[model samples]
Target: MSDLHELRIERHIAAPVDVVWRAWVDHQAEWFCPRPWRASVEVSELRPGGRSVVVMHGPAGEEMRHEGVYLEVVTGERIVSTDAFTAGWRPAGPFLVRIDEFAADGAGTRYAAVARHWTAEARDQHAAMGFEAGWGAAADQLEEVVRRLVAGG
Candidate 1:
């Protein structure tokens, strides 16, 4: 991960690693995007070269579809996907590689999400798009989702 081309949002979540891992992948739609922007996973194959499409719906009927392929998926640990390719390894407009990691921390978990861009300009583009605030708020929502999951909701 290059400091000049990566944006990250990490947090210490008060939940077990498995719970956080589920929220990060299995129940992604619940907290994938910030509020006012809901997400729906169209496909989640969870394997190397598997397709993963998450469509984010804006409050005003706008839709931002993120279509990509999983480069790697480690059960209960991490997910690495990239928009540089869609399903079947076909090329697409390159954006970033998205990495979500969960590690056991005492009785809780440490979660980190990174957006690795191809260039400094792309990194700056994401930062200009309120990456910190948006991703940070989404992280908070993720924690809430984990809590709800633990409560058997």
Candidate 2:
């Protein structure tokens, strides 16, 4: 563990806070990568100290889960959570994720995501795990979802 690691992705979505929040929190929506690695966010509550579970279905339809507890939650602003997947979500490692941070800019929302790791090696692992492409695709998808939803598509 190198002690510091972070991955950043930002974008401007032409939608209000409620729309953006739904795009992020909605589980039935297609929100993951690999074209078929579908994702679902099972957030029991949207507040600090709440529990969130994320499920991903692989190409083989194998399900993987990531569970965590919210450390902080500022409605329509930000969310910080610690991934406890290996213990409950599924047989996986740990991850710290901070996302949904937002700001009002013009008629839309400025959204940012920061993913942290324990060490440089872990960060490298994420990079090798398709961090850029995966996150980039997800970000794009999120923007599109919000845009379409807000536009009443």
lDDT of 1 by residue, 1-153 (tens): 567488999999988998888887777898889998999999999999899999999999999999999998999898999999988788999989988889998889999989999999999999999999999989999999999988998
For model 1, what is the alpha-carbon lDDT of residue 118?
A: 90
Pairs that collide, model 1: none
CA RMSD of each candidate after superposition:
1.3, 3.4
Mark the 10 consecutive residues where model 2 has the least summed lDDT.
84-93
Candidate number achieving the greatest lDDT relative to the actual structure = 1
Total backbone collisions for each predicted model: 0, 1
* Model 1 alpha-carbon drift over 4 Å, by segment: 1-4
TM-score of 1: 0.95
User: Candidate 2 residues 33-145, lDDT tens each?
Assistant: 54558877665566676777778788887998767777778777887777744224353457656555877878988888778886777778888998888887887888878
